[model samples]
Target: METAGLVLAAGEGKRYGMPKALAKHGDRLLVQHAAETLRAAGCERRIVVLGAAADEVRAAAPDLPETVVNPDWATGMASSLKAGLAALAGTPAIAAVILLVDMPGVTAEAVRRILGHAARDALVMGGYGDRRGHPVLLGRDHWDGVARTATGDRGARDYLRTHDVRVVPVGDVADDHDIDTR
Candidate 1:
């Protein structure tokens, strides 16, 4: 079962000032970093969801893997997550490791740990001690439910909350801190 990587890079970054995808985290843009992190973690297929200055992000990071533009991105994160999952519908991926672009601290090791639980019915996420965080692995079996309840900024939180989720501890291997401000 191939686990695809889904990078949600559509946020406008109202708090950080600028599109989060365009934000630089070292030499590469946040979108590039997120996608590269997934690739390094052994995800053979990677898709990036772009919005809120999609053209600029595409121009800035021309090397990004297959990208899907979310027309309703201004609504919230849910749109981007839905767009990314819709793009994955045609692939052979059994699960997707979801990552947020602004989360520059999320490392490949953390994603790899989540990938270990990939399956058609698996719902797993990385845990930092007692706290759960990204990247969340959503199996194909739960995609419909996730998409249904993913409204506004909730994303898959509503669905995951009601389902059996496995939280993999990865604080020692990665950081889940998001770059919310400059």
Candidate 2:
């Protein structure tokens, strides 16, 4: 499966009081870490969505495969989802795209496993130890459902909450967390 990397770096990190994507968790900036990890994990195509701090994030990874801007990002994660999906729609070779960004701790191996288990007709998401979180992998066939998420404050969460997604129990706690908010 040709998996693409979709890093949602557009979030303004309202609670973090800065651009969370740039928030450094270690040697590499958060966004860079996510991008480098995805790129290293064999993602043939990579798309990073940038909004509020677009220029900053874009500059962070100038060698990125593709970068799309979500002008409606202020509206929320749905907009970022729409923007990223729109950019990826043309790549038929793409089986699924893994969403990664500014989160503090997912290792590259975790993404490899998630991409390996991605079901053609479903989304991959589940609990991160004690919490439900991201790095959700949505197959190309399910793009429409995820795209329909353009009207809300999330990135396919509302629909995912109701539908049957292939829950990938992240064995690694780091791969299943959202660092900006908590």
Candidate 3:
């Protein structure tokens, strides 16, 4: 099975006073941490959905698998997601494993686990303590649905509600941790 990794690094980080992707957490930027986690999970192809400080954030991951700039990032996470989905449109054999640049707490093991079961449904998310969060895995079948997502506060949660999901529960704390300071 083919799989692709997508990182959402387009946020303006209004509350963090800088691009969220460039924020420092530990010794690395949040987006770098996230991209590293995804890359470690054995994803052959990677894509970054960038906006705001697109150039700066893209440059941060010089060896990143690939990069896709999301000009509609001003619209919000939904736009970034759709942008990533569009980039994956040509790769029908690969699943898109998405990560949030701000949520650096999500571990690589969790992402591997999610990808391990991607074929179960169109969408598979890492669940922790009753809440499912990112590093969400989407099989090739859902690419069209995700790419067609509309503007104004759209996201995978709404689409998942209409389909069956393979929810993998994690006993870890990353599920409840909200990285956004705002």
Candidate 4:
């Protein structure tokens, strides 16, 4: 099955003091790192959602994958997630693996593992050891509802809570920590 990669990079990052997408992880910008990880995972197409400092981010990573600006980004993550999903409309992608811009610990391996578990009717959640986390795989079947439920900083969390999500262990290949806090 075909899958696309959605990198959520539209947050204001008030907690991190600036746009987390521009934050550096080692030598690469956070957005660049996230986008590269998604590409390395074999996503047929990658969509990045930018809000805060969108122009600066674009300039910083000129080679970044297809990107869209979320004008309602200040509203929260939901808008960005929705924007990313909308950008995938009418595509051949049977699923989308979501990656957060601030999460540098997520590896291509983890994303591939999640992609490997894609089902037309199921949601796959990447797990680090016993903890479920990012690089989530949302089957096309769940996209509409997931987008509808995405609100605030919740994204699909509310929908996932009310549904059955398959967890795939990927700790050996990735870390599930968020670089949001200073």
| lDDT order of candidates, top first | 1, 4, 3, 2
Candidate 2 residue-wise lDDT at 10: 80
Expressed as tens digits, the lDDT of each residue in 1-182 for candidate 4 is 67999999998899899999888888989999999999898986999999989999999889898999999999999999899989988898888899999888899999988898887687999887778899898889998999888999899999998999999998888888888786
Instruction: Indicate the worst ten consecutive residues by lDDT in candidate 2.
Output: 173-182
Local distance difference test values of all predictions, in order? 0.93, 0.72, 0.77, 0.90
The TM-score that candidate 3 achieves is: 0.90
Ranking by TM-score: 1, 4, 3, 2
Q: Which regions of candidate 1 deviate over 4 angstroms?
A: none
Error of 1 at 140 (Å): 0.2
User: What tens digits encode model 3's per-residue C-alpha lDDT throughout 1-80?
Assistant: 77888888888988878888878878877777777888888877778788898888767756555778888888888888
**Over the stretch 55-153, how does candidate 1's per-residue lDDT look in tens digits?**
999999999999999999999999999999999888889999999998878899999989998999999999999999999999999888899999999
Q: Is candidate 1 or candidate 4 better by lDDT?
A: 1
Question: What is the alpha-carbon lDDT of model 3 when measured against the actual structure?
Answer: 0.77
Model 1 residue 22 lDDT score: 94
Between candidates 2 and 3, the one scoring higher on TM-score is: 3
Candidate 2: regions farther than 4 A off: 126-131, 173-175
